[model samples]
Target chain A: MIPGYITTNAPALLIAVPLLGAFLSPLIGKISRDARALWVLAVMTLTALIGYFVAFLVYTEGTLLYVFGATNATLAVPPDSGGIPIRIIFTLDAMSALMVTIAVTVGFAVILYSLTSDARRSGLEAYYTIFLLMIGAILGMVSTGDLFNFFVFLEISSLASAGLVAYKVEKGRAVEAGLKYLLVSTIGGIFFLFAIGILYGQYNALNMAMLADMIQWTPLDKLALVLVVAALAAKCGAVPMHFWTPDAYSMAPSAVTAMLVVASQASLYGLFRICFTLYGITLNYVTIGWVIIILGILSMIIGVTMAIPQKDIKRLMAYHAVSQTGYMLLGVGVGLAVLGDQALLNSYGMTAMEGGIFHIFNHAMYKGLLFLTAGAIIYQVGTSDLNRMGGLGHRMKWTMIFFIIGALAIAGIPPFNGFASKFLIYESVFAFSPLLSIIAMVVSILTLASFVKVFHSVFMGPPLPGNEQVREAPRTMLIGMTILAAIVIISGIFPEFFVQNLITPAAHALTDQAGYISAVLGGA
Target chain B: MRMSKIVRFGADVLFGAIVIFGLYVIMHGHLTPGGGFQGGAVVATGAALVIVAYSYEEVIGMIKKTILMAQESAGLVMFAGVALIAIGLGTTFFFNFLANSGSLFGMTVPFGPNPGELNTGGVLPLMNIAVGIEVWGGLAIVILYMLSGIGKTKEA
Candidate 1:
């Protein structure tokens, strides 16, 4: 049974609030622009509060399973159906709860940033509507217990985010890039649905727990697995499949680009969920793990090298986002590779998983901050091209500081959040293969090199002749960046605590498949 | 892009008939194959017929953007609000509190197929109507926005 508090339905309310907000946004916009903005902020903040409350409950009370449309609300298990849950259920485990926290935080910050940025122009109604819908879709994608439900949410998010990416219609290229993003994401969504259909056809179950129990790991199952991995990999921008990342990220408004990073993370989270939980020990772990690792290395090397030559600031960050996603894949890939040995899994593999999971939160913060700062520059200078940027350190001191923190944090420098997670990854991965650790280190140095170039090119030069009137970004944008920058700083200072409190529980939730299965089935 | 007067007159008659049929499909969804989405598509078809019969300028004059948006939003709010009512009733979200409760949309049915009561399926009918309105307004809005886009391109 759920807890006896208002927080009992927080998980459902978390999704409901944003969804209702999205529908109401245009209506409220008709009343007054300021009312519409306040309404959006209020809705987002409410969702965030509910998100944190549910996450805290999950942390303290173990996993929570919520079944929709049940005759008996507390009963997830139907009596006569032999321990099968019939209706739609939302499972709030530690892993999903953590992701929910990241999504809500980033979304709220982005909305705040958008209030004062270039996104505040006309058409604010459609902008906020799609914006909230995109956030709700991400929440749905990360939190749903049904596989088909995840696919549905994934499609919604991809479409909504693509629409948001094209919000800047004044720029012809934004529309073009949005079409490409939409094309690739739609194709990936189709393949993902096909994979879900295969699994459903075989097992006759849409619920993840029931499917996990019924799966036979047959050839068809392996085909389904490959399709899932490929689809999610493409959506999340993994190496060979990552061509759309730069185009979409660079073309979208900066606030939108920040949220897009989190959207891609939701896809990566789906990939991990499918690999570790759905298919778990049923398939060949070694080969699949190698597939992820090779992709990680390629993303790391290719992404960083590609970023170094970029003239556009947002495009550079987009490539680096791909590179940073590599760290997560490599860290978790090492965990997957060593899952065959139980003793190895308990010791090194679990640590590797924690490192990867830790990086998920850290990257969302610093990378989001980086994108927001890029947006701030664009807001001030009317461009994101690095060649045309200079001397913002004088007028926009706060933005400069924030950008430096973001750059330093992402480059894995000491006493930053990136260094802490990358440290865990390097230390744990070395035992699996020293060469992997070495490659990760080289990627880190290259990351530093690229960011230093950005710092010099964007903020360290003399003010250009045409840019004398450039001012600091609006107070709201600075406030938005400050949220992420503060998170990056605090998490960096207390990595051990965050790891113990947040990352460990999430890692346990992922590796503990039997816990998930039993939690649902045992409820009967 | 207007059609001839006879074609426009025929479309005007067809629109009313199609909307009635769509509402029939939506209302009878509890006992039939076609449901809210299908019914909504039917209604949208009616809207498309209207748009096709008139010039883009004439169509813009006839269609109110705010009204369609309100319809869509109101439908969504009704849908979510129905689900939220369960939470207010100390049950789970979308628990169908009206089911077997003898309230609106509440009347228990016997097992197996029989002559269905209009109120037998509980919140399902409500959900169907809500989703039908949402889809109807959503599809119509998409067409209007697209036609407007075309108008802009033609001017440019």
Candidate 2:
């Protein structure tokens, strides 16, 4: 039997361990750099273990609720509180579990990659601290069932990521990009807070489940929804508000850019949680659904078209990040559009949602791998410009292989994870609307074309002057890329297994509003 | 870049008083309106006054950046450590284990309004102190670094 403490406290431990380790990083750095690196690794490993353990428990037992500051961890509503859950609660269902798994997995790989890749950098203590804090913030944002708590975590992530983005201060452009990111995110955060305030003023509750239980779809609530959707859409780099994304992603350290993909997905998760759980079918589902779908289409079309002409390789990948986010939005948006109709929801809406949720996982893995490969190229070749790179396939064989895997997976080729999710999306979404599906297919083609150009320019030609002596990426960086590469390949080949086991459950958790509400407020 | 001697003397005189008041606010955070963040900012304001009054060279001599960074880290570790201790006691994280247990900061009071007691909040006061220290260190270091950067720009 699992120890009772471990089983009961895994949710808290998952976030707290990284937070503690983050602060302790600088102190440990004082002792020795190697010691600090090992400490960070140990902390991330423990966090990942606890995260997977929690996911396992959530899958087997259904939604798990842990009430902070309570005598019993699972006691969400104390007898004295008169049927109200007053304490901050963590409500982990399959969806949250999935997001947590993605975060910890990517976080662990990024830190491992950074260990050797950034060994020579100065002020590494601060770098590792902010990275751990970002991980902890993402974990907290996904798991918490409190709106206020979610806001707190969102701000923490925004600030920590901004610091990471600005870490390369010697590069004036990096500082400028970080500033833009900071300004945009701060505005988004403030809008989110305003929405939270509106909801609190109406319902007098900060807990997500409680607010959902009491939500009345009043004008104030509608306003709150608008504010929330806009803020989170911006935060997640959807369409018109995606100006800061390319700059930030291109300028940040490669490992951070990879983790930033997961960070933005956390915001996307919050957007879904608010719409599905907070509003449910009470509000106007069709309109909101179409809004997200339109955003997705715009992102897909514009993000790729813009990416095709970029000379900087990382900037091009950053645009792809925006493009991939569109696929997820489209998938879930279709599900939302059909939320009110039971017949339609059961027939294709569920599949669309699964496709979208599965895409979140696949996109994180492949895109993370792609960014790390780009980082590897930069590490060996000393530049991110495609024009300045060539024939790296000879010297950097492992990196070339990793980059090819990422490129193939991202282009939706068969026997890769991206195709499986996109296939689900296309089949289901075509049943919903063929035009949207066609747009999506065209976007995929553009994506493939862009990556093909990038691959040829960066690796296929004769070695350019000053690039002939390029070498393979460091062992740890390759190890990091390999972890994600392995996942992309394995999940691609076994898509059905992951879809049936993890994605289906997570999709159900997203749409099953009554089950989510009852888990926290109705049950013990 | 030094201020007038009179201004420096006044800054020194007010620093201790400001810190003491800030500590008072942090200690009584659970019962009063002020809390760790506010109190810490107040203390940092005092540090900023001192930083402004002295030259960067003299300021570096008086207050080291490494020590401030350590202080900030220690404060956060302590805060997280206190929360984690609850897990060791076989309860969930952030559990108010000491509340009414007659341990450190463990005093129970009757509900519905009475004269406030500083010792009744269980771990909140300790959390307040931890945050106060952290904010004090964090805000002060930011000011110090900014000033140092300004100094470098001037020299260049």
Candidate 3:
């Protein structure tokens, strides 16, 4: 294990470093603009390194616990407590580590992409400050074991991200979208807090492991479960609750939009944490699983159908985000439905979970690249409206290629990461119910068709007369897109390796509640 | 936008008292119910009182934006630095290494409903001050920015 000098404090460092960067960003900005950008980059890179290091340690050494204000990890036990952890606990298992990995990677990519992308905006210092704050809060949200702490981080991220989403001061539309996003997330956060209160009122514990062990599945707990799931699902953009996704995604700066994509995944992480680890087998799996599966199908069908007619490039891509999230919902929902049924689970449930988890990684990479490409086009052409763009591909060849790769991968084409994960979902979900797989396949085709329409409208045809001299994106932006594209390609071609090393372990850790609970409370 | 001279004078007089009360609340945070966030809000109310009485230009002069920004960053850096101290001391991050060590902000005391000693909160008091400073700066700056934004719109 890599539990060396600094590794033991990796959990806290992962959040602390970025938080330091957040305030330091504006300070450094006051001195010099370039210095502030470098500061943000340095901060994100440092936190990403710490994040991956923590993930590595957790992966290798089993779960690593870091308790705040405690002398050591084992000192988390309260003196007169009923085996409940009173201190703030950050429990990093493979699942949380996976989420931390995504947040760090996406955050790093967003920082690099926006280095030059947001040069035109005023208040760059404040922009970087909120961006870093959101990053730190995201890392906090994914890794913390305390429910109320999750709510706190959730609020911080919502505020920070809504601020970023409203970065374009001139674009009144962006601000409007930001306000709506904020209002919706505030309600969701309050609902989530109420759920936490219900749990706390019942068991007098905020720790997930403690609640998992002390659960008497009363009616109030069920109500709490509904509120938590509904709130988190809305936050993550599951179908029927995803109106904010299109508004927020389309209006945000491309860089912030990319990060927002990953942010939703954090909400997904929270949802999965509640479903699998918190409730585990104590909840009614069949009913809840069916509920999730239905939501997944709705998201897949409606998201792609909505994307087909979109003239706005970012809005189109935003709908695609909804569709991609559906695959994950389907994959994980299948796994949830079969919980405690050993024969069915052993046959295909695990693969479904791996597929869902793997898609989180793959979707982040491809969708980020896609958004950056969309941003690049908008940067050069001065609009995100697809009707207003054409033949910039000749000038921006690299961007075109990157966009094509992103489009194809998102369409679930072979030799790309998306195909590998979606294929796994299709192959395994068939075992549970072939109808669901058929619908998924049809949705994949519709997704491909939707992207083709976008590609034709935005990148193909003769150059528009006004944009005769349109140029490729800046060097840093291209480099950022290339980094994500390379990840998409590598994970696509060698997905088995990722599955074996990261996804399978994460899936196992997520499903195995006994191990997760035991990791926190010495065999419970 | 300055209020009448009487109101302005009253605001000026009340600001000092409000700030002093806020400081007391922050200093006794570990012993009392009101901590960093609450005390910072109380302090920010004083800033708001001044902002309400003075014109935008005069308010800018009275509460310099750059200084408030600096104070905010300083508070955050200090808060983070205190936590980072645990990392350097060969303990986990946020570990209360100073507690019960009989050092600065580290005096041990018996747990009870009795009045607690000022020096007995370990790093908690330091954290309170840091957060208090941050919240004060943050809230004042927020009001200033909002008013300035409104000012711009009216002129436009």
Candidate 4:
């Protein structure tokens, strides 16, 4: 049996260890670079372990509620407090556990890749420090059961990631990209705060569970809901609010770009959590669901079409990130559309949600792998422009292989994780509306076309001038890519296994609003 | 460019006073309105005054960037460490294990209104101090770095 202390405190430890490690990284760097690298590795490894352990416990035992600063970890509401949980609580249901798992896994891989890829860069200590802090913030954002706490983590992550985006200050335009990201994020954050104030004025509660129990879909609630959905959609790079996605993703160091994908997904998680759990069936589900679906369609069409004409390799991939986010929104939005109808929901809505959530994992792994490969190319070629690159397939064998795997997975080719999720989404969404499925398929085809162009441009022809001597990526970078590659293949081949274990539980946890409320408030 | 002698003298005189006031705010945070962030910003404003009074080279000598960076990191470490100590003591993370324990900063206050006690509020005071030190260092270093960047721009 797991130690009681560990099982009890795993949620807090999952966030705290990385936060402590971030502050301690700079100090250790004062000792030696190698020491600092090893320190970061140990911290990330421990965080990943705790993350997976909490996920395991949540999957097996059920939703876990950890109340901070309480007499006991499980004491969400004091006996005399009249059913109100005043303290900050972490609600680690299967949905939160899945998000945590993705953040830590990508975090570990990114840090490992950065160890060798960024060894020669200046300001190594600060880079790793901000990296760890971002990881902790993402974990905190997904797990916290308090709206105010979620905002706090959101701001922390925004600041940390903005700093990392500008880490390559000498690289012209990076600082510009970082500034744009910060400005956009700050605006979104203000909107979120405004909505929180509106909700607090109405409900006088910050705990999500309490607020959900009390929400009555008043005018103020409707106003708050609009503000929240807009803010979260902007944060997650949805259409018309995704202006910063290409700039930020293209300019940040590759490892940071990879983790940014997960960061945005955390915002997506917030959007879903609010819609499904906090509001649930109290509001107009069909209207809100249709709104999300329209956003998804816009993102898919615009993201892929824009991606086709991009000359910069990373920028191309970044647009694809926007496109892939649509698939997830499409899948889950379909689920939300039918949420009020139990019979329809039982037939296809759950499958759509499972597909959406599963796609989050698949997208993180494959997209992360793709970004790492692009970084490797930039490392050797010193440019991310497709027009200036060619014929690296012979020299960088492993990077080429990883790129192909990521490319195929993202394009939804069979036997890849992306295909499994997309297939589920297609079949389920088609049942909802045949037109939506067709739009989604067209987007996937465009995604494939763009990647094919990238593959041909970067690795197909004879070696371009001054690139003949380019060698394979370093051992650590290759190993990092290898880890994600292996996951993509395994999950693709065994989609049923992962969907049954991870995605279905997450879908249930998200849909079961009463269960979530009762878990924290103590009774039905 | 350096400021006038009168401005420099005024800054020098007010620096110590500003820092002490900030410390007072930080120390009495649990009982008062101002806490670590506010107090630390107050202290940092004093440092900014010093920076404005002198030139970049002179300010660099007065406040070393490395030391300030270390100070910021140390403060955050301490804050997290104090919270983690609760878990070590068999309570949840951030639990006020010292409150009402009759130890340091552990005196129990009466329920009704009375004169506020300095030796109460358990770990809050400690956290305030930690955050105070951090904000002081963090804000000061940001100003220092900005100045350094300006110096570089001028050279170029």
Best by DockQ: 2
Ranking of all predicted structures according to DockQ, beginning with the best and ending with the worst: 2, 4, 3, 1
- Predicted complex 2: DockQ: 0.89
TM-score of 1: 0.97
lDDT for each residue of candidate 1 in A1-524, tens digit (9 for 90 to 100): 54563666777888899998998888898899889889999999998988888888899999888787775544778778776778888887899989999999999899899888854477788899999999999999888888999999999999998998888875588888899899989989999999998998888888888887778899999999989999999999999999999999999989999999999999999998888888888878889988998888899889999999999999999999999999999988888887778999987999998999899999999999999999999988988888899887778899999999999999999788999999999999999899999999999999999999899888887898778789998899999999999999999999999999999999889877788877777732
For each of the candidates, what fraction of the native contacts does it recover? 0.71, 0.91, 0.67, 0.78
* lDDT value for model 3: 0.89
List lDDT for all candidates, in order.
0.88, 0.93, 0.89, 0.94
The reply for model 3, stretches above 4 Å from the true place, is A1-3, A78-82, B110-116, B149-156
Model 1 / residue B58 / CA error / Å: 2.3
Poorest 10 consecutive residues of model 4 chain A by lDDT?
A164-173
Which pairs of residues collide in model 3? none
State the displacement of the C-alpha of residue A249, model 3, in Å, after optimal TM-score superposition.
Answer: 0.5
Question: Model 3 over residues A171-207: C-alpha lDDT tens digits?
Answer: 4988999999999899999999999999999899998
| lDDT value, residue A23 of candidate 2 | 96
Q: List model 4 lDDT by residue over B27-101, tens digit each.
A: 999998999999999998888888778878888888888998998999999999999999888889999988999
Q: Model 4: clashing residue pairs?
A: none
lDDT of 1: 0.88
Tens digits of per-residue lDDT for model 4, A23-119: 9999999999999999999999999999999998899999998999998999999988887899999998999999999999999999999999889
Candidate 4 at residue A41, lDDT? 98
